[model samples]
Target: MKNILKVLRAERDWSQAVLGEKLNVSRQTINALEKGRYDPSLPLAFKISRLFERAIEEIFEDDKGEENA
Candidate 1:
């Protein structure tokens, strides 16, 4: 999946580590998500959505277009 995590974080002047702290994840996890190397779980996705005040769709995208696949 593709996501705008890096962009969003940059817009807020947040480092990956800082984002990780806010989400209670490791910095490496944030890095993986930003680099499209890992996908967040549903609960984590909701946390991200709420933190950014964006819909999950706005933050993350299903590159395969399989209805959230």
Candidate 2:
């Protein structure tokens, strides 16, 4: 999955630590998410979507190109 987490954080002028704090996660986890090294679990993904005021599909995208399926 690819997400716009870093971009959203940057837009809000939020540091990874701050974002982690808001999300009740760790800085390392934020880093991994920003780097696309990890995909968020369903619950965490919903948390992120709610925090960003965006839909899950708006934040995270499936790279499988299965939208047409």
Candidate 3:
């Protein structure tokens, strides 16, 4: 999965630590997600989409594209 987490965070002028604090996660977690080293679980993904006021589809992309990669 690829996400626009860094884009949203930067647009808000927030550090990973700041976002982590808001999302109740560690800075490292935010860093990992932003770097695409990790994909967020469903609950976390919902929290992130809510925080950004965007839909999940807007934030995260299924790199498999349509049917297959």
Candidate 4:
């Protein structure tokens, strides 16, 4: 999964810790997400989308070939 989390965080001038605070996750989790080393659960995806005022599709790109097709 590819996500615009880092871009959004940069736009907000938020550190990973601050983003984690807002999302109720750990900094490590935020770091993992930003690094594309982890995929968030569905609920977490929704929460992030809402927080960023974007649709889930806008924040998280489903690059899995089957899903896109």
Task: Assess every candidate by TM-score.
Answer: 0.93, 0.91, 0.91, 0.92
Per-residue error (Å), model 2, residue 29: 0.3
Candidate models: Cα lDDT each: 0.96, 0.94, 0.94, 0.93
Which candidate tops TM-score?
Answer: 1
lDDT for each residue of candidate 1 in 1-69, tens digit (9 for 90 to 100): 799999999999999999999999999999999999999999999999999999999999887788655
Stretches of candidate 1 exceeding 4 Å from the true structure: 66-69
Cα lDDT for residue 24, candidate 4: 99
Per-model clash counts, in order, read 0, 0, 0, 0
Strongest candidate by lDDT: 1
Steric clash count of candidate 3: 0
Error of 2 at 27 (Å): 0.4
lDDT of 4 by residue, 18-61 (tens): 99999999999999998889999999998998999999999887
- Residues 6-64, model 3: lDDT tens digits: 99999999999999999999999999998889999999999999999999999999887
Which pairs of residues collide in model 2? none
Error of 2 at 23 (Å): 0.4
* lDDT, residue 67, model 4: 78
Clashing pairs in 1: none
